[model samples]
Target: MRNSRNSKSNKSKSTVMFILVLLIVGALAYTGAFGINNIFGYRVKSFEQAINKGLDLQGGISVLEELQAENIDNETIERTKELLSMRINPEGVKEISITREGSNRIRIEIPGEFDAKKVLETIGKTGKLEFKGPDGKVILTGKDIKNAKAYLDEMSKPTISLDLNQEGTGKFAEGTQKFLGKEIGIYMDGDLLTNPTVQSVITNGKATITGSSSLEEANRKANIIKSGALPVTLEAVEFKTVGATLGANALPLSMKAGAMGIGLVLLFMLIYYRGPGIMASIALVFYVVIVLLAFSVTGVTLTLSGIAGFLLTVGMAVDANVLIFERIKEEMKIGKTIKNATETGFNRALSSILDSNITTIIAGIVLYSLGSGSVKGFALTLMIGIVLSIFTALTVTKFLLKLGTEMGLLSDASHFGVKRG
Candidate 1:
């Protein structure tokens, strides 16, 4: 009687935990970090909106710009590429590609950017930021700027605060002392941004630029200033806007292929391993949900190559389940009961699964750190998939198999693909 009561209590707890897991997965699948408005007037955030598509999925603008300075070196080009990437993408834009073309040129491709002219103006501008005294003598340049940020002032107005390096601070102090009570002009590419009166000689390295029309404008200025000025001026030698029709069509085909592949995997798992395969299939659903949610939350831009990587990991996920199930069958054939066989199988398979996945993950990390563009997309997706695959195989599959045995559904050796000895 006591054993019966304990068994019932454990089954009830398992049921509750399984239901909780289902609810969490469902919630993650439908809603992400933000809310989305549907046609029926309901607002809910979805993984579809959270996952950003790359250039191959939604085409946009591409620009080829060349440095205007003579004797431009590879070092200067590399630095410019890094700066442009920081300025254009920052933390908001996704899947923006900036690469070097030749000895003196850069190729920039930004997907889903609507304003080509605005992008051109922002990226191609010389961005020679300067602070000048009333007599038009340059006091400091952007190179001297240590940092720049946008913030709200005491009156709730938008403002840009500048932090200058030691050299800039000294130069600014000297200039302010020489021109007290006069205006200091702030310029970018010869265009005056603001001219503030030097009320007092400032010794501190901090200064603020107020009078921005709005917070957006202030932020824009701050971002440009913080990204630093290019060593050589850039001229747009070629510019074009790419259409998305091809990418749009390609996406459906790619998704169809992926769906078909995953469907086949599920069917094979269900048929080959029987009851355990069914459990593995269920765990796979959780794996997919978790991986997609991870991609959405991490802001990983999904490209064609990334999708391929994801599909590859899906196959590996099935392979892991197969290894464990075969090991279970072997243990069961050796006269172990279903519960003991399950535990021993997982233990025997653990080392191989971890070794394979960990090595793949290391390769993915290396690729992500060293490669750029689509290579990075592929590496990121591969890493995410491998991690989720391992979790599902070890945790979810193991729990479900145990649950099956506890419920008396998988007591017989034949239920786990083993013949009675």
Candidate 2:
């Protein structure tokens, strides 16, 4: 009778501890997602707002352009993209992406861009290449060149290798002789690519340009010189104009559906597995926080597809808990103590969880390697989710279960989904 009274006292204390855990975790999760106003003199912004959003989640313009040439090949398409990249990314990197969709189509996506007319004008500009001498006279044009390549020097520094045709060779030889020791500028569409002083006269039609800071810079300059004019014209076949309001509408709907599903899962866990269910729910809260923190730290661009991957992982996490809970019930029915059953259950469930998650992670890798655009985004989120799911299932869930056992909250068989005789 004295032992029974002590058992009841311990269970009551555990109940109070569980309630406190719930309140604290819930408050923290809410603050992390939505944030609050200023407490003293400092203002706080939400982590969610700081995270980058995709064109579907934010606002953007997508253009599908087709090469209007009879004999266009993959090499030509790549060169075309290089040309467009030069025009769009002249200053530096922006929220822009240029990718190949099929054999003849190239897709360009620019996020937070709504001015369709201005964007179209920029895309339409296909400028000529010119090599102007010291006196601003045209020394050589792009039509005279055979090919340009970027390579490394003997000292492992970056340089550009120029190859000229017969006509360009003669003209370049004469020009170099006249302009020796003078600076001549290589210009593409009125923008200066490089200005190097003439070192000597070259009759062999090959020259090298040094002073490139890096291989990447040399490659950019070489690509411009090699493909100053595209092999075919890019006709904008499809223009998709997405507004910020549309994305705003999409986010709320997606959130509503996701919330409803998560709420139902939490409710089911609470109803079925009494105490272990509560512990798993708390671990899940931390799982969510960790996943979002990972995304924020990595600067992952979130999209609707990425959100789908995230939600799918949430379900997988719940499935793991369900498996462990079932195993605990089986162990308890065989006359084991609650703590012993918990340890055995987690061990038994671990192999199955690892097998399932590892297979999914491999699939995510395949998708990420071969896929493009939104598909790649989804794959990244899926891989991240699978890894995090395994971590929380093994570590966080087990820790919480162990905590409950020590607190004497899981002494009853029914608390782990087992029915006592």
Candidate 3:
């Protein structure tokens, strides 16, 4: 009966272990860590692809637009900020930063190749909403426009159609009727953006702006229309555009340096920990994958400083594994079974792991709040790395260790660097 009970327990343990491994592996596979591409058709984005590279590594433009102080209320200020973001990111800019500098100013930084003049034109222009008659008659102003959206025509051309309120609709219908066969000029901040001729009476309170345009231009105009009009005008105070050549030079150098650091760290781990070091190395690979996935999912920007943070967290992760291994070795020296030593070592190390991670997280939070630009990037990545490291250390490493013990792979104390009792 006792032999049968032991057999049942071993079977249950095996089943549980198999299920856990499958879950972890399945999750990883679903996340595109194993496949050539993610479940989606697109190639799985790598660490470089997922985390947005910053200005130092990617070489791009950083335009700073400062807002002048006005008697703007909070609601209007928020609305204006939204409008500016829409204009700068019409086709969805990457790693572009738009931050309120002070109570009276805003700072815009776009980290990619972009036309300085074009970006300036976008940032400096006060998105003026306009309404004109079919015959180019001045009918109503942007204040009359309640909402706007973009759609595609039968020919697949992007069309920006807008709706006016009941009062504006009535006025717009009247204007359309009076100015048939004429063009309506839509001016933004006194600059003509679209001029379309009115064909029929638009009594539905809706009008479509049609013109020849590129995909990006259509999207920009649509975004500008959607954001409504800014309460206050803005001017570009500072703009800097970095050449692509400059970014090309920096990217390779940065990658080379980062690779060297990682290689050295891996080398040191192998030398110090031996067999257990290989386990930590495997966990580290998973660590990198988890970190990259987190960044990709969260859209975290990767600057040179962020990479530095990641490297530091790598060391921290290894440190946690080292602590657990050393404790297990000590327990083994006292004649504890391999399973008992492993279990106790993990339990004993839990508090220390939590304490170390909590302290690092607190510092990361403080740095994130106080830092700006690359510093903020570093803090954000560091915080993510620390949290992920804890998961890998506590969960992934523990599971592997348990599996090793069950497989009789680490039956002797010498496997973990301890003398037998």
> What TM-score fits each model?
0.83, 0.74, 0.75
Which ranges in model 3 have alpha carbons more than 4 Å from their true place?
1-45, 70-77, 145-222
Write one digit per residue (lDDT tens) for candidate 1, span 1-421. 9999999887777767766766776565455534467848876656556688888788888888988998887878887887788667755446787876657888888988868878987796666888898888899898999888899999999999889999999998898899998899888778786787877787898888887888877877777677768777888999888789867897889879987998899998887788898788878877877787788778888889999999989998998999999999988888887888889999999999999999999999999887767887899999999999998999999998887777666768777767784
By TM-score, the candidates rank as 1, 3, 2
Q: Once superposed on the true structure, which residue ranges of model 1 sit more than 4 Å away at CA?
A: 23-27, 30-42, 64-78, 86-95, 99-106, 114-121, 132-138, 143-146, 149-167, 178-183, 190-199, 204-219, 233-240
Q: Which ten residues in a row have the lowest lDDT in candidate 1?
A: 26-35
Query: What lDDT would each prediction earn against the true structure?
Result: 0.83, 0.84, 0.75
Candidate 2's displacement at residue 66, Å, is 0.7
TM-score-better candidate, 1 vs 2: 1
lDDT of 2 by residue, 53-168 (tens): 88997889999998887767778788788778766665334657788887788899888888999889878876678888988999788888888888899999999999999999
lDDT of 3 at 418: 72
Worst 10 residues of 3 by lDDT: 29-38
